[model samples]
Target: MTTQQSASLGLQAETKRSSVNTAPEAPPYCGGDTPARRPEFFTTVSSLLKDADGVTVAVLRIDSPPVNSLGSQVRVALGRELDAALSDDKVKAIVLTGTGRFFSGGADVREFNTSKTKVEPLLRTLIARLEQSEKPVVAALNGTTLGGGLELALGCHDRVASPEAVLGLPEVKLGVLPGAGGTQRLPRIVGVAAALDIIVSGDSMSAEKALRYGLVSEIVQGDLVDGACRAAAGMAKGVVQYRRLSHKPLGADAASGQLFDDARKMAARKYRGGIAPMHCIACIEKALSCDLDEGLAFEAEKFQELVNGDQSKALRHVFFAERQAAKIEGVSREETPRIDKVGVVGAGTMGGGIAMSFANAGVPVVLLDSTDEALQRGLGIIRRNYEATLKKGRLTQAQLEQRLALITPSLDYRDLSGVDMVVEAAFEDMGVKKSIFTTLDAVCGPQAILATNTSRLDINEIAAVTKRPGRVLGTHFFSPANVMRLLEVVKGDATEAAVMAGIFQLAKRLGKIPVQVGVCDGFVGNRMISHYTREAYFLLEEGATPAQVDGALRRFGMAMGPLQMQDMAGLDISWAARKRQAATRPAHLRYSRVADRICESGRYGQKTGAGFYRYEPGSREPIPDPEIEALIRECAEEAGIRQRPISDEEIVQRAIYALVNEGARIVEDGMAQRASDIDVVYVHGYGFPAFRGGPMFYADTQGLDKVLATIRGFHAEHGELWEPAPLLVRLAEQGGRFSE
Candidate 1:
């Protein structure tokens, strides 16, 4: 049970040789440690030419622009070139490499669902050809080699990589196992434990680590192509002996069995909601037990199954959704403004977090507060945060000091005059925010961008007080700003295009996913979550408990349950907001009083040791309380609501559909550019499960008609609280999806 596939492909017979070479022989082109430049030559995605020596050694370069992704055309071309090189009598050996920064980034993701992916000369066919070629093929990993790219290299007889090259198979992140021999060949080269670690984590390793793991033959410091060519020539001359990865024996024993068992446990815990890691582990186990041909077929079958599954579809939707969020209307063509220095007003919780974000990006920041004591307290929190990071081994002492040194805490407004951008993370009062903006407008430079960190306040009123309305917008960083990855860039009515472009670019620099949203009561995420949380309360009032509601959503892949999230976020925060809006709340609109009652008892949240649930003195774990359930029962009785036994399915449908219905209204209102942008805000900002995509994608998957039918039923039962959005009804009638 060796490899029937390899023999059918006409690979040379396997020869016994020592895998470990005590004194590894260098290639003929090996020079001094100095970085040497590769010989210049023009080449396309697939072209064969000779190295500096002569045409005796054929050199094939994959030169597709932006990372040589293996599309249909590239694969077909490489197949043809490989056949030609193998047929040429003068060509002794072939060296394969990439032209630019990446050797190959894997498959063209854009072609995943298209017919091109299934066309002739597929990646599998090309890699098999490389494995069976008469002439020895040396893979020159020029830079980053990932997914199918690494599989291609594994097919070659030998591999040489540039020192800066990074290699891995990250298909697991996208909810699919690597389809192109990655699972089978990788374990054969780097043992089972390392293979599981690399594949399960879906992380890239450095070239040095690749060499150490015997994944590559050598770490070529300079001129990757030249080194590969020399290595190929050595193999042709019998100076170097390399074995095919497929023919290697899988030393499966008790230890290997333990490794697979451990991998299963890890995948079940870390990636509970996804099926990709489990599939990856299963493929590796099959590879070890079966022959190469059977294992390959098994891998291909599993790959097809996972790729067509809902989880992969949802994950892929998220992949494209993030890219779609980057294109802001009327801002893509504008010249981005330079922001070298940042100023943060109100050195409280959010202000300190925002300041730390800028400082972490190596930008100098001025943190301003009204009193010296306030500034000192804010600075102390930043120090403790950095110290925690250092203790976790995430940051060095130098890095902590450098980041801390970038933030200058002060009480004076004059210190912000020299900063390029000023963000006000003050209290969420219109008057208080307007006063700060007015002062910033008068004191700060005209070119500086004025931003507010208000999560729900109107940016227009805050900008109206300042003469430079065009320079004002909202940068709604989520709670604990420095740790969160979402930055909702709220566009004001008078916001300039350049200002939007600059902030978008700046968000990327700070390692955040920036989604452009129009100014409104809660913008995209919070506005939609309002409906979601409302439904959760309604469920509670009916028959469900906090633990029941949270458990249902958590099983559905949410990072946290709505009630648990409310408890952790402090129920009083939203209670105060509700009190402010109560004056304007419509008379007919249904409102739940359970949360208000909890707040009335002075139970804030984890901060106050009780809210939706009680917490221990030092622990933040939510402990279900019978007293809270009694209170909910009383509220329901007073509201004349009949309690019914609610299934988990009903709970999930009510909560998720609420988000979809509200998201539709937001899209119809043009607050968000597209449905995908709304999805991005939720996935990155609101802890919506990435595997389920976002509410919009989930709606599409469930079918708009089905969603509408459920909503219509809810509307009939719950009245205005569950009213189907006009957009949802329209799309359902038209048979259109949100993605379209």
Candidate 2:
């Protein structure tokens, strides 16, 4: 038990002064046992793991400098300390745990490959020393035990865990098998079928479930370290019993592992083309057929295959990219403002949904509209979304009522006072949004920040009308804002760093991931749309039907094809924008002309019952319209465009590269901070496959050189739309990444 957390009643020795010199201090991120430790960044690890009370039931607490990763220093210190304790005759039992909320976040990914050769030898010595100790060993799983941390815990004689603990060997999620004794020991303990499930899926399990599976010997009701000590004390005198996982005989024979065969069949179907899941299956097979050491050897081999692999490296890059993308220059994270109260202007789908996002995060929301009917409709939608959550067991009735109470619907601008921020989610028109901001500027206090939920309009233009333009920014939430994780925080020309910081903090308060962007029409999300749409049109003209192109892109993991997405979103939107684009075509962009012809007719989209695809009432199924096909042919004739057979490869390449090209342009224009930021937007807001990473990531992986080559070829054939970015061309030629 910790003074910083819950105190224990059983400290025989009186607590002494801080052991700054004698003991290793806990780092800031790891946390410590002091009043000052309440603020995580201030706590020193030295105070948390003081050697003053180093005793028989010593819990080797780990919360490594940050993210408690199992790197070289951690491994060395842990092994050395445990060895010293085991050698001391007075030490009867050792209980290992971690500080604060987490145990260890597995092995330190940064040191992985560099320490690969040394890993097996170190692990063998550590496991041997721990297992062969005259003193009993107990592992107190304080929080998440994943990868090698789980392996270390599994090696102990007894396992005791807290209720909040999550246990698993989740290396496979990063496309690698658990390298340290996972495949062998886990299957031996939990049976082949259960072990395979965790290993293959790379999914974590609750401590309660782990207890049911007999993974942990006991569960802690109160403080975790105390429970661990009690268990260790019991086992020290032979009161607690445990079976070594390596020595346990199977309940059923080896051939009885037909259960695993069936599981593998299902796993293969579930995890198609993925290597780690299959490798996990093979590890399970080896565990059933051979001894523990043999199984561990097999696991090690598979781990090597994964560790040296390109996929795992790509996954690791993405993992780090997500963490790094959150940093904002000139914005002090220490100055994060509290977003307890919010105002939502508009009683439409976006406003209602965004209001729900705030309420879900325990912030009160004031929803405003012109009439009670519109306000009631927005409230009704909020209620329905919460009701759906209730049905899914995600929200309790009491919790739902508490959240619903947070949202106060009103029709007057006077009610918007005393709010930290106001999100104007009104219609996507400049005049309406500007008028709302103008009204908000006069009504709200000087400190209140104004945010517009506009998708394509310029944030700078919206902020231009406000008295305090520095406080005006764009919080562009995707459709169904509550459900979508991505929030693009557009920093206007005059937006102050504090205001930008507040919007980012507000986004975090709403349980949304925020990526800061610069002001521009369509910003990052829709700008990329031009490329994909152009390719779709080119495909249609080249004798490929809309169905063919749609099928190809959809098969490649896009939720919908470019044409299909246009139809679903209503083509008239782009059609209206295209009219302006056409007037300034040579100045803005090169013309494609294919989409204009489709839109010039009364073909709006699903809303108009006709576009690229025909729709039946109340149905999502898209039927390719032959009428559109005939029109395409006629348009090709009128435009004197040559019609020819198109390949699926051409369709996929042309469409996707257009997106990459546009992204390069966005990056070069300083609209985006980094290429990875763009990827994050697409990954969350758009349906870019997680496995393939996002578009920018995908481009990086494809070898920028190769991408540039494709773009160059497209440029020669198709003109300015295919013109590669100067930066992109340079990076590609230098054999570097877009993010780099």
Best by lDDT: 1
Q: How well is each residue in 1-740 modelled by candidate 1, as lDDT tens digits? A: 01122122222222221111112111111011111232343233554555433436667778655566776666766777777778878778988888677888888776777787888888888888988877789999988898888999999988988878999998998889989988888888787778888898899999999988889878776556666776776677776675666554464661367788888898877775889999999888886777777788899999999888988888888887886687555544437788999999988899999999999999899999999899999999999999999999989999999999999988889989999999999988898998898899998999999999988889998999998999999999998999998999999999998999899888878988889899889999888888899999999999999999999999998888999999988898788888988999998888899999999999998999999999999998999999999999999999889899999999999999999999999999999999999888988887788888899999999999999999999999889877888989999999999999
Off by over 4 Å in 1: 1-48, 51-55, 246-249, 329-334
What TM-score, over all chains together, does every model reach? 0.91, 0.87
Tens-digit lDDT track of model 2 for 44-101: 2221221213344655666464545565555666776676667666667777777766
Judge candidate 2 at residue 262 and give its lDDT: 81
Report the error of model 1 at residue 498, Å.
1.2
Worst 10 residues of 1 by lDDT: 24-33
- What is the Cα-based TM-score of model 1? 0.91
Candidate 2 off by > 4 Å: 1-11, 14-55, 116-134, 166-170, 187-206, 247-278, 281-290, 587-611, 615-618
